[model samples]
Target: MSDALSKPRSTPGTEPKPPRPVPHSPADDIPDGAQVLLAVIGIASAIALLVWGIPKGYHWARAQDWHHFTQWAATIDRPVHTYLAAHTTGLPITAASAYVLWQGIGLGSLALSWATGATGARLTWIAYGAATAWMVWDSSPATGRPVATALAALAWTVGSAFALRGLSLRPVIVNR
Candidate 1:
């Protein structure tokens, strides 16, 4: 009672306290080496597909008289060699198996470009987006359910958005 009476009373009934500042989170921080490693892994994987997988696929397709017209070059989507894995026998390195590598050079270039801090970062997005589009088109069934292709496209789109956002935040330096 004495303390309350002696102390200056708040306006009417409300008492105002100092505003608390919002704390910043360092969780999003990524180390330079880690970023480089991630980029390298992505690039290397892509290169392996282009260098090894695509050539083998082309050869196989040629032997089997399948289309050899820029399969991976035109479109670099992942999750390959589905039919082979579905087989009852153990995974065999058949001609068809050679084409299983996902998102060949197209994806790899993008990774390398982003990793090395190369300029024109915005342009890489075209390849990033086109790959998903190509996959959607290639994977779509001729005349059946569209569930699988749709789901994959959706997932890829979300993933691409996240990756692109991460890249976009990077500081850009323009030469005047």
Candidate 2:
């Protein structure tokens, strides 16, 4: 038989060949615009909450409108409470304590998101996810607005996750 024919054919029946390591390309490694978009979404959402949400909350509080305040609080607090209640039951804790804990977590995540790196992206995902959950659960008169905000937050979370995963796959060359 000819050498070509005699040579052992590397076919499906034979042991599979080891995958060749692909040479890393800087272009291939770099993150796309999605990361920036996600980061921007996170920042804008946080700013909105701090600017509009906080003031609204304060207004409700100052007015001594317990009903409105509870509704507002539920919008911001209920999701976190629900998450905590589901995940960490049996722990002796008051609603105030839970709120504090959730706030701490949100703040920490936000801080990390501001810092440059993969941690920032991961933090953005977590912070946005929590915020989205909160908005969805809270019973607010501005229900339509919260729905839109929650959807935006969810988009940010998913986008950030994709960006972070992409970054992990290869070194991203970000333009300063």
RMSD of each: 19.5, 16.5
List the candidates' TM-scores in order: 0.29, 0.33
**TM-score between model 2 and native:** 0.33
lDDT of 2 by residue, 64-102 (tens): 847865665455455555555665567788656876765
Please estimate how well model 2 matches the true structure, expressed as its whole-model Cα lDDT: 0.62
Q: Name the Cα RMSD for model 2.
A: 16.5
Listed per model in order, the count of residue pairs whose N, CA or C atoms clash below 3 Å is 0, 1
lDDT (10s digit) by residue, model 1, range 1-176: 68878998777758887899878667448888888998999999999999999999989877893344444322323332333233424555652544433344435545655466444543554554555555455554555225545655565565555445555566899999
Please list all clashing residue pairs in model 2, or write none if there are none: 75-138
Worst 10 residues of 1 by lDDT: 72-81
Clashes of 1: 0
For candidate 1, what is the lDDT?
0.55
